[model samples]
Target: MASKMTSGDLDEQFLTCPLCMLHFRDPRVLPCLHTFCRECLQEWATKQQPLECPTCRTQVSLPDQGVDGLKTNFYVNNLLDFVAVKKGAGPGVPCQVCEGGQDGDKSWCVDCAAWMCDLCTTVHRKLPGTKEHEVVPAEVLKAEKDVSKFQRKRHCHKHKNQELVFYCESCNALVCTACTVVDHRPGNDHNPVEVSGIADDKKDKLRQLLSHVDPRLKEMQDALKEFDKETMKLDSSRIESVNQATSYFQHLADLLQKREREILSQIDATYRGIGRTLESQKEAVESGFSRLASARTFCRQAVDYENEMHIVEIGEQAQRTVEGLLLERVNLKPEQDKVQFSERVSVTDFKNDVERLGVVSSTVNVDVSKCRVVTKTPVVGLECTSVLETADEEGQAVAVSREAVSACLTGPKGNTAVPTQLRAKDEGRVWEILYTPEVTGRHRLEVMVKDRDVTGSPFDVVVRSRESAVITIGSEGNEEGQLKKPLDVAIDGDGNVVVLEQVNRRVQVFDAGRGNVLKCFPIDNDGLFGTGTDSNGNLFVTSFGESYGIRKYSQEGELLATFNPEYLRHPLGVAVLQDGRMVAADKQQKSCLLLQPDGSLIREIGKGQLQDPWFIAVDQSRGLMFVTDNRAHKVVVFDLEGNLKFSFGKRGPNRGELNGPTGVTLDPAGNVIVANKADGRVQVFGPDGTYLRTVTTTRGAPHGLALTPDGYVAVACYTGHCVELYRYK
Candidate 1:
C-alpha cells in the first residue's frame, strides 16, 4: 500500500496555471515560457491576434498546424500518474469507478482523475482507449519524498481521449490533435510552437519583474513611516498652540475679575458712608422729640392737680419747663441729609468705559496697495488727510462700497480719533481720510483698505506749531561752512548739528537754526565714520579702517576719552543714550557694542546675526536699540540687555524693503527712521517694528540720520555730498 499524503505532498502546487488556478491541463508552453491549461489558453487566444503570452504579454508566432504543432510536456504526465497512484493506494480508499459497494482503490488514472480497484485497474489497462496510458507502481510513487519536481497535466475537454499538445500563435490558443485539424488548420494562417521550449524564459521574466518592484515597495513603506512622524509633530504643535491661547485668555479674565472686585468694593463703601450720615441725623431729631414730650407731660400733670397749693407749686415748675422747652431751640423740623446717589448711568456709558479697558481691537487688513500721509501742513487744531490705495490680492482696484475700507487714527495718548470724513475715490483704489487733531503732539494715522492695514500705514504725523525744515546745512566743498563727503550728521544737546566729513577727516559743528558752521576741527585720523552727541552736549565720533575706535570729545574739540575694545574692530556708527551709555555698530566684528559712560564695553549684541552692521540708534524711552545690518539688509532691534526683540526688512527695492541700510535714528514720535543707501529713501517704523511710512526720498544715498528737537530729520547724503533736512515726527 502507498504511504498517506502529508502537507509536504502539496509542494508542487505552484506548478498550477494562474489562469485556471488548477493543475496544468495538457500542459503546453508559450513563447514567453509561461505554461497554462490547454482549454484556458484556447479561450484566451480567441480574443487577440499576434498571440501575446497570458503571463507576460510577450508576442509569439505560431506554426501552421496550430496547437497540434506545440510540444507536449511528457514529464508532467509521468508526475501526475505517479501522484495519482500514491494517493489512491492509501488504506480504506474506495474505487471511484465501482458501481455499487465501496471497494479499496489499487490504482488511479491521471487523465480521468479517478481511483480504481485491482479488478478495475486490470480492466482499465485492457481497454483499447486506455491501452497506452502510463502507470507507475503505487509503492514506487510512495517511496519518493520531494514532490516539488512534479507537474500534472489534464486531458483535452473536447476530445477526452487525446491530450492537448499544441498552441496557436495567431489565436494564442492551445489545442488537441483533432482541434488542430478542424479549427486551427495550417491553411488558416495559424502559427504554433513547442510549449516546452519557452517555459524557462517566462520564469526568468517573472524574476526580473520582482526585482524592479522591490525597491519601489520599500520606498512607499518608508514614505508612510515619515508621514506618520510628521502627523504626530503637527498634532503636538496644534495642542501647544491651543494651550498657549487658553493661558493668554485666562490671564485677561483674571485681570478683569480683579478689576470688577475693586469696583464693587468702592460701591459698597460709598453706600455705607452715606447710610451712617443719615443715621446720625435721625438720632439727633429723635432726641429732640423725646425732650419735647417730657415737657408736655409735666405741663398736663400740673393742670390736672385739684389743690390750689399743689397746682401753684407744679404750675411754676411746669411754666419754667414749658418756657425753657419753647425757647430751648429744640427744632422739630430737621434739614434733610440730601445724601443720595444719582441715578445709575445708562448701559451705553458703562459699555463705553468697559470697552476702553483693554486695547482697541483694529480689524485685520490685508488688501492694501499703498498708504501715505497727504496733509501738506499738519498743524494743531487743523484738518489732516491720509490717503490709502486699496487693491485686491491680484492688484485690481476694488469697486466703490461703504465699509469696504475702515481706518482709525490713534493719538499719542492711545485714544482712537473719530474721522470727520472717510470717502472712496478713484474707483475705490484711493481713500480720502480727514480728521482734525485737538491738541499739538504726535498723532498716529492708521489707514486700512478692506480692513487690512495698507502698506506703510499708521504713519507718525507730527502736529506742531510749525511743520517744516528750519534750515539746510553743508554743500560740496572743503571750505569753512562747506562739507566734502559728509558721512554722518547728529544734533547736539545745545541745538548744534555735528557733521562728520569722511574725506576731509574733520568734525564740523554747525548752528542748527542758521546752518552756519560754528566750529571745524581736523581730526588726526582719516577714518571718521559716525558722529553723535551725548546728553551733556559732549560729542562722540567713531572711526573705522586704520583707526577702529570710538572717540569722545568735548564741544570745543578737546578729546575727552577713547574706547577701543578688542572686540570692536571697525566702529561705523555711534549713538549716546540719555544716561551716557553708548551703542556702537562694529562693522568688522559684525556686531553692536553697548558701552558704559567710561568707554568700557558692556556687551556685544547680534554677533552672528548681523552682517556688516553700519548704524546704531537708541530709544531710551522704550529701552530699545535699532541696528542697521548693511549687508544683511535688515534692521535688528534689541533690548538694553542685548537680547534680540525682533527684526524687519529684507533685501529688495520695494517699500518696507531695505538695501544697504546705513544711518538709523528715532523720530520725535518714537518711530525708527532708517536710511536706505541703495534705495535712497528714508523709511520709518513704529517702536515695535511696524512699518509706518517712507518719510522722504533723496537723490543720492542717505546715510547719517539725526532727529532735531524741532521735529526735523537731518540726513547726510554721502554721494550727494550734502546734508538734506526733512520735517519728520
Candidate 2:
C-alpha cells in the first residue's frame, strides 16, 4: 500500500468520510484515526448515541461538542481543496466501526455510539465496552440537544451521540423518551411535542407578520431615500457657494496685483527723479567744494601775498592714505579747477559726478520761459508751484553770496500770492522765463501748473549760473509798503542802523533784526546823504538836519549836539577818527569836511577839489579816508589832513563802475564794500581801490554793509521787505 499508493508529497494527506462522503471544509481526525469534515460528522451521527468511529469497528466515544480548532481550520482546508482531488467512491455500509457482529447490520446504532443495524444493535448491546451505551435511530443521530444552537458548536445533553429528542413546551426544554413520557402528562397543563411542530408553527406565524409589515415598511424606506436625495442637493449647493467665494478671492487677487504694479511704477519713477536730483546736487556740492578749496588756496596766496604785512602757516604732510575712505576730494581736470567726490551720489544709482552745477529745489521748479525780467527791474504776478524735495544737507557748504543782492517786484495786484501750484492761461503748461537781473547772482524762479483733470506732474526748471560777487545793502519800495524808489543805508558806529526810504521822511531807522520801525528821522531838507559812527559807538549821522551838516547822537536817543562844518553844503558821510576828530564828505560841494570833537570846524579835502562825493570810508590804520563820487563814478582817496591822494571807480557797469553808488564801508581787512544801487549790486575793492569782485544778495537790498569784528555782515534790505544779517567766511 505504501509503494503503489505513491510516496506522495505533503499535499495529499486528507480523505472523505465513508459515511458522509464529503471532503472537509473543516477537517477533523476521529479518535480512531479516521478523518471527517465537521458538518459530515454531525449528519452521520444523527440520532446516534455515544457515536463510534466509522473506520475502526471500535466502540469509540465521540465528542459531544465540536472542537474550536477544527472549526477555524476551514480557511486552511480551502488551501487544501485547491491541491486535492476527490476520493474513490466506496460501498454503502453499516457503522463500519463496531467490534461485535452488529457492525454488519442493515442499520447504524448512533445512540449506543456503535454502527449496527437493528439486528446488530442487539448483539452490540451485550458487548463489554458498549453495554451501557444508549441505542438510537439509524442515520438519525442528530439530537435536539446536540444540534447547533448557534453557528459555532453542537453538543449532546448527556452522552455523546444521543441527542435530546422530545421538547417540552411546558418547561421550554428538549428531552429524551423517558423525560417526555414522565415529565409531560396529558392535559395536566403540560404541553409536550416534537421539535418539528414548534418549528413549523414559528415559521407560519413569522410569515404572517412579514405579510402584514411589507408595504408600510417600504413606504418609510422610500421617505428616507427622498431625504437622502435632498441632503445631497444641499451638499451640491454648499459646494457651489464655496466656489463663488473662490471667485471673489480670485477677483481680489487680481485687484491687488494691479495695485502692486501701480505702486511699483510710482516707486521706480520717484527713484529715477531722485537719481537726477541727487546727481545735480552732487555736482553743485563738488563744484562748490572744489571752488572753495581753490578759492581758499588763492585767498591764502593773496593773504600771504602781503609778505610785508602778516605771517603764514601750513599743515603737515600726510603719513598714509585715509582708510574706509569717505569724503576724499580728487582733482578732476585740475587745471580747470574741477574736482569730484570719491563716490558718485546717485539716487537711482548712488553715483556722484565731478563737474560743478546747479540744482533746482523741487519746490521751486519755475518756468523760466514764461518769465521776463531785466537788469534793475524785477518780475512779479506770476503763479508757481512748490513740491518739497529733500534738502541736500551735505551739499549745504556750497558758497552763495546771496545777501548782497537786492530783489523786489511790483504787480497789478496786492502782495504777490506765491501758491504751491501754477494755474495759468496756457492750460497749466510751462512758459519760458526770461530773467535779466540787474546784477549777477544765484536766483530761483519757481512755477507750478495745475491741470483740468486735477492731475499733476512735477516738472523741474533749472537756471544754472556762476555766482557773482556783490554786496548790496538797501532797496526801494513805496512808503506805504508799496513800490517806490530806494536809497543807501548804513550801520553807524552805534548799533542804530538807518536807511534812506523813498518816503517823505527820507530816512527810516528799521530795526536791524526785526525790520520794525525805530524812527523815521526826516533829513532830506537838511540834504543829508550819509550816516557814520564815532569812537564812542555813537551815531554821527550826516544829514541836512541842521544847517546841512553832521549831527551826533549817543545810541540811546540822545541829542549830543550838531556840527555846521564850514565850506560844506551836503554831507554824504561822517566818520570819527581814532583821535576824536570828525570827518565828513560833502558831495554837493565835491569836498571833505574836518571837524573838531568840540563841534568846531577843521580843514577840508583841498576845501574844493572832490567831485560828486557820495560816501566816506576810513582806513583807520592808514589814517586815510576814501570817498565815492557818483558824478565821476569814482572814489577819491584823502589823507586825514583833507588832501586828495588818488582816485578810482567809473559810471559804467564795468569792473569798477559804481552805478547809482550809495553807501561805503572799510572792512577791518582794509577791503571796501560799495553799495551800487542802480546796478542793483555791491562791489568789493582792495585797499588800493583794486576791483576784487561783486558781493551778491539773496534779497534786493544789501544797501548798508557793516561787519562786526567777527565777520557778521549786516545789510539793511529796506524796500526788499526785510533786513538780514549774514556771516561771511
TM-score of every candidate relative to the true structure: 0.37, 0.33
Candidate 1: segments with Cα more than 4 A from true spot: 1-470
Candidate with maximal TM-score:
1
Candidate 1 global CA lDDT score: 0.64
Q: After superposition, how far is residue 341 of candidate 1 from its true place, in Å?
A: 47
Off by over 4 Å in 2: 1-486, 492-496, 500-526, 545-547, 606-608, 697-704, 708-728
Model 1 scores a TM of 0.37
Model 1: per-residue Cα lDDT over 578-677, one tens digit each: 8888888887778888888987888988889888888888878778888888888999998889899999999998888888899998866678899999
lDDT of 2 by residue, 626-727 (tens): 777766667778888766788778788777777766667878789887876566566788988899976553345444456644344555454564444443
Error of 1 at 400 (Å): 54
Under the 3 Å rule for N, CA and C atoms, how many clashes does model 1 have?
Answer: 16
